[model samples]
Target: MAGDLVLLTGSTGFLGYIILTELLKHGYRVRAAVRSQTKAKRVLAGPSIKALAPTDEQLSFVTVPDMTAPGAYDDAVQGVTYIIHSASPIPSFGDGEPPAQDQLEESLVKQALKGALGMLESAHAKAGGSVRRVVMTSSTVAVVPFEVYMGQGTEPDRVWTSEDRIPVAPGPYGFEFQAYSAGKAAVLNASEEFVRTRGTAFDIVSITPSWIFGRDELVTDAGGMRAGSTNSVLLGVVLGVKNDAPYGGNAVYGPDVAKAHVLSLDPVVKGNQSFVLNSMMDWEDAIAIAKKYYPDAFAAGKLREDGKQPTMALKWDASKAKRQLGLELAPFDTMVKEVVGQYLELLAAEEGSK
Candidate 1:
């Protein structure tokens, strides 16, 4: 009965779209919350959703455009027994001429915190009595020392546990990455704050997934999808968008991350908790896997071998996710193969269309 009826926000996002299919595959009835019901239907009716064929009377959509609006999710969670709050405002560069760095950081942090609090407060008021669990899609930006790991600053690497403080502010400003990290950190802090004061009406589990790599089924074959910065690293490499730039980290397969969200709904789980998730592969290893598996892409110069490896490598402790959620993270090579292979197919489709 845990999967009987669930309300899922962010159904239109890359991760949320995948999570939708994963939930349906697990036999759950999902009430997708999207900004536009028509757009959601159009996007979902494509080959990707058709391939999955997850249609059911229970699989429906409700419009919630302004997630930050007061009582936004109140009606959405009316009859739902479970919730997966994956919908967070991903920072974008916008049309042209980037805004002031401080302003961008402030806006993103505010929006992220507002959206998170909206979902938490709504769930507490509307669905608290009956909702089983709320699984939030937090990012590794909330856990790892990205400023230190990425060499963006001189901050020393701190021992990061679920209880560690997330520093997203007070100096080390000016970069979009830092802004995004601050936003993610704000969400995590907000989740803990909600749990501590709100008591245990419903269990909240926040999953902090590192860079997610895999073919995005929702994106077109021409590779014009608006993937997040984390995913854009690999996709950008494959599409020649950032051929010379090497980016890598503790990466995880996108589907594996989705599967973790589904697995977190076990009834035995209780209270509030957070888990870091990732595959044990750095950037160089992942690229090697791509070149080995999809030689054609590499040969065509679309997938370059010139990307740089990280000077300061970092490792993630995903044992908590494996232990608590029973999730066995996918291998680096396998995920690389899947992502590259799928990109190749998309490229071919694009060429055929032209």
Candidate 2:
């Protein structure tokens, strides 16, 4: 179909904005479902989006009421032939649920699945013989445990992708990553059940990626901007987290996370093409790249000039994504260096103000 009318949930979100920008590049007719149109416009006006010159009408906005409520996307999913559901919770604090014990089991995860089922049902009804596919954003946490680290001999490349689906962590890392992982796992599992039970209205596929790091798409309001500044905090944490920094997490770039969604959206990739983006690294690897490419800044921070601290290797595999989705990832150094440069500039401005 020429210019597929695509429906994107969580359009106002960080990864959502990147997906919007990338989709716009292909001129895919997109409808971004936002909680508030006015707030969305402000986000669109931000540096990340303003550069794209998104047409108001082309970039249509819809009100996504409450995610917890099912059928929230009923009307929005009406005519959209392609659906990219990149909406999920990334915990800032620990999982707020009473028991971290209960959360690690599968509380939040089942919730997302419930939402996914609602969307799938809506899409099944509205396919109008046109709905081709549904692409969701799963996380690298879905691939396995946090122990899949580096080994002996040559650097055995292993990262999150579509093919692997075994738990590799020590099992019970915590409810935070667990909820996120289990939630994605629920959706993927639910999607499978959907196809098995519903008989393929549109093949369901998902992209499991790592922690996304990039500039905020829209500043939103001052409050929203402040909240969105998590982007910066996460980036800066690397400079200061030092040895005590938490490093056993999966990571990926915002653009790649968005692209993995797009690749899944393309008619070329379907149920057979589901995968994850696991181009993540240990804190040491993360720091090494920072120090190697940005010696001056690294020296300024005085963060491990000796060497990177040791970290557990996480397991990830991306062959399917490479072979099928055909994603050529940018170097890890480039991605980290770019963000570091942005951080350095921000620091300089902060110092100047003082």
Candidate 3:
């Protein structure tokens, strides 16, 4: 995507900030479409971000005018060769049980898709043609459901992937991972349909990420909660780091996740391209990294004493990403440290504000 001016929809988010920083690091000029240009300024102040923009000469910011309206990106679609649709709803640590937490309000998967589809429409209406590609931010929760994994073979209450392994309107129970992944799966399904029948000229790809932990440019909201901030599993451990909990979830570095998004958008999906970043990891790895860099922030919590063995196929086939993106993920030690360090920084900042 070099020499290309990409339009980013969620430039003020954690992953968005990292993605923008990465894009600018690679010399890709950006048009950050966010809700508040004012808040966008603070987000760009992160050391990592400031280093990318250097000066706001080529960088541009625009308040996404009516993203849910008829054609939000219609006028904003000028000169942008690529679209990085990275905005989505995420929850702070342990904040739960709200109707919004269901991804309808926070994730806004459907509305975002509508906006994305509208962009394709808006792009086609452009004088030249539709945007060349639309890169979406999907969650790993979409790839596999937690209930299925948790049930495995023993928890008779477990469910399994269906023939299509896709979600339907009357789909499986909406557990946390299931619902989140289901939302992403729905968007990808929609994207594929739109591209195949309506806008073949526009390429689309989905980058699914797991528990993302890293430094953030987006400040804590007025409520003091932010996506990727209040991780229940981590918090449970952080709350219980004093104890040992055998925990293993697909945790990756934020920067690596951002890099995966860029590489996935390289117009190579039909070419068997993949957008998955971060290989699977187990509890000990997270514990070691947490202990080294954030002894106070992380903990080795006491998990189900199922011998701490990998419950199921806790791996994802990221071979395509490696082959296509040629990306080398940061080491577990480095990635975990960066994530824990960020959590601590967030904790300190929150305490100071109080």
Arrange candidates, best lDDT first. 1, 2, 3
What's the TM-score of each model vs. the native? 0.88, 0.80, 0.78
Tens digits of per-residue lDDT for model 1, 1-354:
445888988878778888888888888999998888786876577565677676666488889988888889898888777899998866553323454776765566777788888888888887747786889988877865555645665443543555555666653367666677878888887788887888747878888887777767666644444253345565554454433333435788888889888888767765478778875566666567777877877888768776655524455567887787778888877776877777677778878888
The TM-score of candidate 2 is 0.80
TM-score, cand. 3:
0.78
Which runs of model 3 end up more than 4 angstroms from their true locations? 95-97, 100-109, 150-165, 169-178, 219-236, 241-248, 265-273, 294-313, 345-354
What is candidate 3's lDDT per residue for 248-306, written digit by digit as tens?
24566778888877766566445212366655666445555566665544333322122
How many residue pairs clash (N, CA or C atoms closer than 3 angstroms) in each of the candidate models, in the order given?
A: 0, 17, 14
Query: Which wins on lDDT, candidate 2 or candidate 3?
Result: 2
Sort order, TM-score high to low: 1, 2, 3
Q: Candidate 3: how large is its RMSD?
A: 5.4
lDDT of each: 0.73, 0.64, 0.60
